[model samples]
Target: MKDTGSAQDAEHEVTMLKVISDLDADLNNVVKFHERVDMSLYDLLEQREWEHHPLHEIRPVAKQGLGVLHTDIKPDNIMFVNMKDQPLRVKLIDFGLAKMASQVELGMEIQPCGYRAPEICLGLPFSKAVDVWGVGCVLAFLYLAQNLFSFKCEYQMVFII
Candidate 1:
């Protein structure tokens, strides 16, 4: 029974490798794989189109248009969905911390320590720009495969930044 299981595992591994190789060969320019499927803000930035979802206009950054401040923009909050045949699409999840641009207050604690913007860290008045900062951190993490500023504490994060 042990030998049979081992053989099956080996066979599956080979099959996976072959599939990966075939995929690599098929795409001359395979986008670098990120856990979030390499989703970029380019489309959101350049197109500046907003979906009619119940959520806010969801524009890129601030002052560009009406947008919500996804205060906790992190890799874990991003998900690739609708992947069955169509090009990969991502949806920002976990809006528990989200606030409208007009609703956000000064010195309100938001965003993870590492992704927190300097203004947020310093208890200064902040706006949707903090969300942009969080997105920048997420982008850095996706590209580098690790947190751009990995720190155990907010002080360390602020110092590193």
Candidate 2:
């Protein structure tokens, strides 16, 4: 039973990855860079009417070779499900905030509130490193079972900025 569950979980993870990959590819193809302006995920989402308005633009770079930027990669966006008796697998959900990066400009800023990188917080141009930072945070939560940065008040997250 455990073996069966494990197999299913693996299959599910693969499926989710494939979906993300496809979406990333599509986003990459549609978004392109220009001399004057960098296209952000928020712009694409807003243009496509994914939502009435763009949410906080987060990481704008494509990381892990994924074509699109997962600007919002909070723990809630990850879905963990057990397959039979196999180990749990993670599925990235909610692409509503994702964007294509070939269009980002020099002055644009994007990133989540807490998981945001120092460079972004300082209003500097960012890259895939933002996603790497978020990944690190997620890993810490998964493995260490704690937040990457701690604070008494949520607003204190700015200190790390």
Candidate 3:
């Protein structure tokens, strides 16, 4: 892919990063400590590879416009919650930019500043992958103690990433 100039889709990369993190944690179960607090990874990926099931889980978004998304998946949205007789739980909230997959037309930019993915910047069609990017970004944040792919002013963030 050619180098697309500027931050047209600034937050696009953020969600993809989150996806990567989720995969990493699920595959490796490698936990990292941030500020002495145990930051558990997202438990999204299934232990078994997704096979064709009689009743598949992933279905096309309904025409009524209601798909799955926690659009603005930044660190702030990742809240640590407490439950009865259970360890700390992670809750992802703030679906400000969320939209049904069927409703998500191509070229509609999303995510927060500094987390834009390349596809978003390039104005390509996006889907559930955006959430993965967000989760991967969160995992990176936990490990790096800083925003890994956050662009400040220019698009240098992409180069570094």
Every model's Cα RMSD, please? 15.9, 17.6, 14.9
Can you rank all candidates by TM-score, best first?
1, 3, 2
* TM-scores of all candidate predictions against the true structure: 0.57, 0.52, 0.54
**Segments in model 2 whose C-alpha atoms lie over 4 Å from true places:** 1-65, 81-85, 106-109, 150-155
The lDDT values for all models are: 0.56, 0.49, 0.48
lDDT by residue (41-156, candidate 1, tens digit) is 33332233422222132221112111566676765655444344433345554444556577778888889888899999899998778877886776665444556785469988
Error of 2 at 95 (Å): 0.6
- Candidate with better TM-score, 1 vs 2: 1
For model 1, the superposed segments whose C-alpha errors exceed 4 Å read 1-66
Best by TM-score: 1
TM-score of model 2 relative to the true fold? 0.52
Better of 2 and 3 by TM-score: 3
Q: After superposition, how far is residue 81 of candidate 1 from its true place, in Å?
A: 1.3
- Tens-digit lDDT track of model 2 for 101-153: 67555555555666666666566787766766776665544433345564343
Task: Score residue 20 of candidate 1 by CA lDDT.
Answer: 38
